[model samples]
Target: MAVRKKKKDRRYSKGCNNQALLPRGSKGWPMIGESFEYFGAGWKGHPEKFLHDRMSKFSSLVFRTSLMLEDVAVLCGPQGNKFLFSNEKKLMQPWLPTTIAKIFPSSQETFNSGNSKFRKLLINVLKTEALQQFVPIIGDVAQQYFESKWKGKKEIMAYELAKTFTFELACKILLNIYDPELIKYLFGPFEAIGKGFLSIPIDFPMTPYRRAINAAKFIRKELVAIAKQRKIDLNEGKATPTQDILSRFIVYRDENGEFPGEDEIADQIQGLLIGGYENMSTTCAALVQFLAELPEIYHGVYNEQTEIAKCKAPGEQLEWSDLSKMNYSWKVAREVIRLTQPSQGYRQVMTDFMYEGYSIPKGWKVYWTALSTHKNPELFPEPEKFDPSRFEGNGPEPYTFVPFGGGAHLCPGKEYARLAILVFIHHLVTKFKWEKINADERIVYNPLPHPAKGLPIRIYPHIS
Candidate 1:
């Protein structure tokens, strides 16, 4: 919470160097800062409370605070969101907590400087043409996944089950690793990694941080082995360069004509899987939770999906064409994500700058929260209400409804995530009707939002 004092230099006398120009908000407790209060609100399932309370008290669009021992400015509303998203690498730079580097040491450079290149690679693989081929493939996987894990079950934990579906899909579509045993073995470490990202960075043995580091090592070693064999297969003409992301990364060279090392490739693959699985799985779970609560909305989605289903021959999988017709279903999914955005995006100040007359000091962090913007009555009327119709036309203004972020930092795998979600919904609505087992399941954020009881739900198969 310590703000740098004015130095003898005249330039330091102005802008953020002058403490008086700093945003108005308490840093909370020393060292611990407002970390507890900030996260506590999220854990209570009202993350917007933390932002709204401060906004009301300060009467400002920007406020200073501290979290994880770093000073921050919590930027509010669409203007703040636009500034950060539009000024990326200019006024602000993407940042990861120190713990992220400690956990995945080998890929630190990739996470830092090479992130754009990594994103470009992902966009190449997940582009529309590439994803068209995956629609039916994802449908086939979702069908089998539902039949085995969801079919004939009276009640099931939706969030936990959704995690399985997303992880299996990541393994299948991204790495082309379809071995159930290997996928199951890989799942544990990935879960540990997710839990450790925002945990205390103390690396003491048995701590979440230490466990995550060890888990990263285990996953990296396994991925390296996989990448190495993939390289051999590519050289022997047994595998095509475009076969899967694993093969693509093994064969891909940067603009400088440098191919990533096996260890680095492994780290990047792990990053992609972590990024892909966590948010998408949460979206899938939230979709289920929302649909269960609103039978009318669920019925609308069912009608839309069933209409698409009626066109397909018996046992025929969903096609790319069918996905376009899933307009209403996508809107429902969009609303789910808007109301329950996984986590706020973080950016580091690239240089001292003035925003809304408040000085943002270089080296400090900035947080543009989706919950605040998403739930703002100004941007979204009855923001607390579940209204899929809000997304009917052009949708909530450009930067106001950022579920996958915006501009350059926008999630590269957004298309793929959409495809995956729609496929799951298509197969789900067409096959079964489900209701929440717990009428009031709380959502908790372990840095990522998840239903507290894993969103258990009862299912009933539709009559043939």
Candidate 2:
């Protein structure tokens, strides 16, 4: 809402002074930029094509390119991952494009910085030990999902069902809103808001970006109403404060002993909603797709889950210990996601720095992806093969298989994914075998993979 400018550079070397040492690549045409080129490749199912193309042409790990709204240096592989992941608020800081930032409850001062209080609070709740409590709840949700949405339906769209399933899980676990009607009501705006993150920034009639911002407003209206009523419920002892994030927020107080405003509460809820949205759902669909395609891999998961079920009493849900013993199954999951990681990560250089003999100017955006490392034959022998055993003992070398990303800024939902995916896989493999309706279904990237026809599949329930 405020016009802002960067302070004079009294700290770092001025203007690409080490231009000779900068990575080699083109920024494409002015204004219109390489955004189209990047999106074109993604829409064609090659989300990493833009980066891979430049890598082969320049033969360099780091290359200069323009993307979205700025000139960025595309950094590749483990070392690149290390630089971006490890240097949070050190040599670099988190970043989002100005146009896209408008869609978020953003402040130019702290936008994507590691110092966000909201992020800190979120991590505190989502980290290792705290997530163990959600295991059975997630397992129960998975069972219900199959019973209502999957079982008895001879054929269904896997991706579409997966999106709804994950959204419901998020509502139940994160917000404590387990009513199906309520979840579906909130999902419409959530779905629309998600598209804006991957769309052109043009905020006009029917544009994805415009729709996204509009959805955010609609979501806030509903969430604010809920939050306001929740505050009254907490004060009157009609609600337990220990329930979910919305309830938790009602009782939380700042250093000044005051509760956050309604808008602030909505923003935090938005943060929680979007945190694992794309990565988790897309990964869930892909995990099912890959396992369905590879019988042997699916068998491994099936065997592991069967053993775990045997250990439990009849009709008991999956527990944390059961989740722990899902090693081979987890390995299959790791391998599946490893083969298809996020398109890329974003970082903004905080100061001029030198890396591997290249001078990276301060303030330039940095993009990193694991595909450079994930697909390298050296890191993974016969990388094309989906051998879950590759993840058996020690797993792929550090930073080489970063499907959930790495370091301080790593996605806080890694543990959530581990349990949630295993829960879904456990139910999937245990009850029935599946087959793809479209064996050659294509993967189109709308910044994330969407299988052709949303991965329609026929569920052959086990013949008892």
TM-scores, all candidates, are: 0.94, 0.92
Candidate 1 residue 457 Cα shift, in angstroms, is 1.6
lDDT by residue (tens digit), candidate 1, 260-349: 888878888888889888999999998898888889999999999888888889999888888899999999998888888745767888
What local lDDT does model 2 show for residue 252?
A: 74
How good is model 1 by TM-score? 0.94
Runs with alpha carbons beyond 4 Å of true place in candidate 2: 1-20, 105-110, 255-258
The positional error of residue 24 in candidate 1, measured at the CA in angstroms, is 1.1
Judge candidate 2 at residue 232 and give its lDDT. Answer: 88
Model 2 lDDT tens row, 1-464? 89789776433335656443667778788876788888888788766677778888975478878887587888887788877777778888877777767777543344565536556666767777888777778988899998898888899998988898888888877778888889898898888887787787888989988999888878878888888988888889988876776787767777778877776777677767776566778878888789888888887788888888778787788877777788888888888787766546678888888877677888888887777777776678887778888886787778788877777777777788788888998888888888999998867777776775789998888764
Winning model by lDDT: 1
